[model samples]
Target: MTASAEYLIALAGNPNCGKTTLFNAITGARQHVGNYPGITVEKKEGVHLFNGLKLRLVDLPGTYSLTAYSMEELVARDFLALERPQLVINIVDASNLERNLYLTIQILELGIPVVLALNMVDAAASRGIEIDAEELSRRLQIPVIPTVARSGTGKLELLEKTAEVAAENRSWKPLHISYGADIDPVLDQMETDIAGSDFLLDFYPARWIALKYLEADEQVINKGAEVNPELSSRLEALADHVAEHLQKTLETYPEAIIADHRYGFISAVLKAGVVHNSQRSDRLYLSDQLDQVLTNRFFGPLIMLVILYAVYKATFDYSALPVEWLNAGFTTLSAWMQTIIPPGLLQSLIVSGIIDGVGGVLSFIPLILFMFFAIAFLEDTGYLARVAYMLDRVFRTFGLHGSSVMAYIVSGGIAGGCAVPGVMATRTLRSPRERLATLLTAPFMNCGAKLPVFAMLIAAFFPARHAQMMFLLTIFSWIAALSMARIIRWTILRGPSTPFLLELPPYRMPTLKGLLIHTWERTWQYIRKAGTIILALSILFWALMTFPLLPDARKSQFEADRQQILSQLPEDTRTSLMQPGIAQDGLTREIAKASQRIRAIDRAESEATLQHSYAGRIGMALETLTQWSGFEWRTNVALLAGFAAKELIISTLGTAYSLGGADLDAGMSLSRRLASDPQWNRLRAFSLIVFIMLYAPCLATVTCIAKESGAVKWALFSLAFNTTAAYLISAAIYQGGLWMGIGG
Candidate 1:
């Protein structure tokens, strides 16, 4: 349906309120995940058909209040005031009636029509608490529906009520409440001034705008100041007067007074039989009971490790079969093209450039998809919050807030996440220094883009212990991130640290349907990038690796060698060797050996040609410096491509090996090629993995870092510092291992 024709409904609530579950149920496979404009906050929209009309639901970022203390609050505020949805579905947790209603009241103040979904009714009943939905709805003058959003109970009625409310022909004005004797007169005067000037009144209700101004909302105050400096000055003067009066009277700010009055309104409503509780106030729920042990000081960290290791094992081990299948499929397709097309630059470009280059990255699709599913499961079950809670003490020792842990986890501390979002997650940190340290170090986590490279290397060198190796790598990434953060905090970015604070949401079993939605959203993102950006960069890097063919003299030498090998064999035996499979005599074996030798020589010539090409020259130039890290010119090439995007490390290696080492006709996986290559072995592979994990982030993440930190120098510093750090550490490991007689 056309967007204009569809009814726009917004779903908003506090974090962990079953809002997402309700959205998943109502939308059901019709959702799209996107970022809000100019920010990293995710915008999730879904559509549902209702009574011959279409309902478009946009899931706003979860926030506790409408006060502009965070980017989420601002984004939600803008979407409501500007887009002006017909109705908002405020999904309140029935179990946490008062706490959830805090957000509901914020939404109500926005003046939008709201249908309250008192979700988790069963959980509330189990706690011996009940909410009178009708009475609450009457008191709030909005439709209220009690729903067990998880079980699909009361979902239809909620949507039906929402549609009824949304279709009504009436204008919404912001909710107004008295803020007591001290501030009421000031608020009334500000409202009069706002309405008289018609300042921001078209978008926001006059009193609401006045309220935000009184709360010192920077966005609102700035906009007002911009619209009318004189009027804004007068309003601020009045707000300052009230702030001084309130501080003298009750020792608080205007915002605090406003909040107190809001709660007072809610308390009065609840006192009028709107809620009933028959159980003990401190009764332990299942989540609380689980938390007692799960979030223990000692065992919590251990259990987190065990859970993370299991996720790694599940992703790598279960994904092996599909990974192999995808590798084989791409190989087969490349082979088919080789047979059909005449051999030359066109055939080589199609096979080596497009197929092998892109296919190598795509081959890990199963692992990426599976990893996303495991992460989604952890997040959906609310264990991720507990993880951060448990890690708070660990982070504080290093001068980070508990909030920093979420950024690390989101960036792939557990594996299969993105650094961009991780950097954005630093917004939760109130301390600039801690946030900057996190922004600088978050890329060290093993993001999904780097997962394929690590997975491929592990498969090639550590095949027998695939899962264990991955688990170790994950731990190593965390160690590097935390260590780098500690070093950075203590030195360059050192400043006062913030106290630790965290909210551990109650644990719930992840719904299978919700897991699928989240998994598909992330997997589709990988597939999309593979089709577009990765595909383009693959072709570009292919040309860079393929050109500057061996000189005519060099070609003549190889041609002469090929002729000598052919001349040594009988014509029939040589001809038989040319065909792939045939009976072999003593003579045929000699001929086959001669043919294989000639093929190897030609491959060497191609390798030499790549060494002389533009990309090769750059890699070769860096070889002397990187040699200490055990990176040869070819590995140097992969590392260079990695800076553009980590996925390119795998693709570039695939192309590099495909060009000169393995004949496309052989159809071996890249891991097999690397395993067979004499230049690569266990020590060098480990070194490369270490370097890739700790080196500079992809260009996109660097851009985000620069934007978020508001300094290009920080991005540049990260590039230089991380590269230097990764090189030294890798060199140490490689040199140390060599000295210990670990390599052949």
Candidate 2:
């Protein structure tokens, strides 16, 4: 359908109200993502085709209110007021209808026609809330469609109703609500003055503009003054007089009164038999009952630990077979390449460079998938909020605002989260210092990107107790992050401590579709990284490791040794070996042993040539400095590449070892290759794991830190501090372990 012919319908709602689930159900994968105009808040738009009609669906940011308090709210407001969608589906949490209705009321106030999609009606029902959608719709003068977005219940009807509303081409009309007699006079005056001057009225509804002035919304006030300073000044003076008059007489502000009246209206609506909340179990819902223990002060922390450890156990247990299968698959691929590519640089490149490098990435796909699945399950079940809730005390102890807990949790505090969103989540922290501290340390969590490296190491060296090791590593990360936050807070970013209050969402059973979709989204992201960035680095490292081929003299020397060993075999055995070699088995065995020695010599030469190559030279330089930390040139290369991304550590190690390290029986995974090598052992493997975990945050995360902090110095500090701390910790463990005879 033509763009102009398509109807524009916007979806807006409060956070966590299943608004996104509804959008996904309506649009499926036909969605395009971009940023809202002049804001970093994401904008999701898609097209839904029904009966050959195209509906351009825009998913606006999830916002609590249409106030100019945050970027998200501003984007939601501007898009509705300026872009002017024909109809908006205002999704609300059916369980918490009262609180969710607050946002709905504000949206309706913006003069936008809204269809209240009563999302999560099942959740509301489970909580013993029975909403009369028709009664509520009558009161609000809008259509209300009960829905369970996750299951697509009522989705078709919601869309059909939406199309009908859009087809009506209804003219915009503002919803006016009376604030008590205390404030009506001032609002009336402002509306009259605003209408008289036509101050920003063509863009904003005249009465809404008056209401914004009453609320003292900065954006609206600025816009008003920019349009007509004289009129805006008069409006501002009137608002100030009302605010002062209210504050002095009633001890409240205009915004507070407006909010109260909105809620008052909502309370009156619900009290009119529109909602029948079942009197079940002392009016306590299932979530509240469970939270009594899950968020308990004494047992909560202990339970959280057990739950996290179990998640790791599940991850390792389920992924073991798949990881091995991946290894065997890589090995088989390498063997197939050997048969086709012939024994030379091209063959080596295919076998060692591309296959092994990319294989190192593919090997961890199962583990990453499992990790993401577990995390998604936790988040979807609403336990992630409890995780943050239980950790609030720990955060306060570490001198961090409790709001930082969610940021850390989002950053993979339990494991498998991303730092970008985690960094953005810190915007909720009122204290700038606390937010900055969170921004700097959130990356310390074992994000999904780092899971492969940790899982690979755990499987290789601590196979017997991979789950235990993973649990310990997670604990180490938390200890390090909290401790670092404390240090930085007390030193550079010190400020007043603020209380962090969190809303604990009701626990719900995660649906299979939700888990699979989340798991695939994150898993696919890792796979794409492997195909693009990791593949490029693998080939690049392979070139750096392959070129500067052993000089002619050295290559000839190895060939001469092979020939000399062949010449030493008895003549009878040589002819007989070509005939019935069993009759001269002893001599034939001698030739085979000599040939094995020659191949060993060739491998040694390859190792030497790799050491002399460009990347090797850099690795050698780093190796010298990192020797105390038990890192050889090969590990140094992997660790260096890890600064860009943790997955690169695997690809770099694969390329490094494929070119130089002791040759494995062809096709063994990188983990197996490292395990069989002399340089790697349990102690050194543990050290390397710690080093990679604690080193500089990945480049993308570092960029986020810098941007969030609005200072490059913090990013620089994170790099220098993380590397220095990682170095010292790794050195201490390696040296202390060696002293205690722990090194193999």
Candidate 3:
């Protein structure tokens, strides 16, 4: 393409157009997902090798048009205009050609080399519709390849055509379409002034900029004003004059006329023997027939609930044994480390700080894996979109836009997502108040970080009803988020509800390869976070719970008690009992009795030392207030660490218990130890789950909320409001449960 070995190609299309499926097919596992610079919009890049040439493919955010109405559109437009990828594979739905072509027309107007991917040809064929790709391509003067991305049909041909286009090394030639006599004169004058002055020409073509102004695109108008106020003012006046004249004459805005013309052009092209429909007009397609029942007002919500419960039940049932296996493996590893390392700071650091702490979080990978698999399955099947559609009715009642459903889902409304992306996803909302309300309440959803904590507590306290507990938690999170959104909307961020339009994609069976790739991508993110952030925080919290050792007098008292017990025993028995793992082996009755007593002393000494440490003291200080919610000093420390990252709750608790000598025998899981703790019970565990689900989001999420909302005050409000509400509600539940003698 450019005499270099690597060519950059951008894959872009409307959402639900199989763009991602095609990208995955091309790149397989060679992909990286990250945020665009200075924005949280996800940037996906992958390498595809063809004909001994490495082509780098960037999967741009899915958007309906190049107009900057949402963040996705902005990112896609900026990448194309600024980065100028060598070629673009514009994926359009073959079954919905007219609607999808709107974006294609906009892309072509940008003057970049484009190859139209008429994706979902099989779906179109299933509906008795046929597309003449050569006819369409000839009309548009570009390659049009029919593809079924889900099954890799026509994939090779699409890539080859894209490579040929890139090799052409063509200069950009902006497409021109007439918008009738009313606006064409003004548009031409604006374009001439724009080009003669080279105004904002570095990033956009002259005619394209003129069209943007006539459309009243906010981002373009603002940029034009910044670049040259006087010229921008003249152009704006011309655009306004044309807009007013068109509005008065035709009762339509410039953008409306522009869209009508674009559609007009597409219609003319298709009418020229480009598309053929064999089905009767009255016949309903398969997707519409399915939607009749799946999106029914009465049956849709019920079916969604049933489906969600099934997902939870399957995940828990399938993951339980693997979770136990991981727990056993970590416990064995911890014990092995203890046996190899002598009893000292080194042993404690490895056994308690690193092993016990990180292992607690790691043991839940099976659950995370299964849950992610379920989410990916639902997403790939397009059922999640229906969930959002059904929930929109309920969301509207709670002052949330239907678009908010996606934000919540991405935040784990279904229960395996994250708040950062959920917060970032709010960029799609047009209403400022609705967006703010959504982002503020989004963290209440059970994100992946909170998943380990919930899984551990449920296993320890509600073992018999894993799926039911998770389902109820999902229900509770939705209730909490919606109720809070209503309150916030009616109070500080007051606003009337705006309309929401959602496009439901046709359901396609997910390929095992795609599902596994998605599952691993999400699960690996969870595991990676555990290994990095959670590991570091675990070590830090461990040090806080381990340092400032007991005073010399207190240490001497415990040492004296140990020696006293040892002195009374026979020298051989004392020596044998002192060695690790020997006390559990053959021993006389008297020696066994003495060993138990000494072990009790060690537990007491360790407890005393923990109480004297920094984290313990902090927890103790908060106990007076938090005890009302059934949390003790140890639980308080764990909750404190949860603010940094929710996964740390399990790890911090593990470290705290390991340091406090909570009867951690080799191969005993953290849940078992927690279950056996005197201070923990069903009521307390449920209360803790409630608090963790509703409390302040992790620091990363708070930072994201701030960045997305463009204000630190809202972030602070999220933290303060969430924590306060969580404390009050959890305290009420705990106190009420105790009054009723329920699991007290």
lDDT of all predictions, in order shown? 0.86, 0.83, 0.90
lDDT of 1 by residue, 372-448 (tens): 99999999889999988888888888878899999999999888999999999998888889999999999999999
Q: What's the TM-score of each model vs. the native? A: 0.97, 0.89, 0.97
Candidate 2, 609-667: lDDT as tens digits: 88878878889998878999999988887887888878888888877877774343465
Top-down lDDT ranking: 3, 1, 2
Q: Residue 647: error of model 2 in Å?
A: 1.0
Q: Which ten residues in a row have the lowest lDDT in candidate 3?
A: 576-585
Candidate 3 lDDT over 660-703, as tens digits, reads: 87343545678988888777899999999999999999999999
Residue-pair clashes per candidate: 0, 1, 0
User: All predictions: root-mean-square deviation over Cα?
Assistant: 2.0, 4.0, 1.8
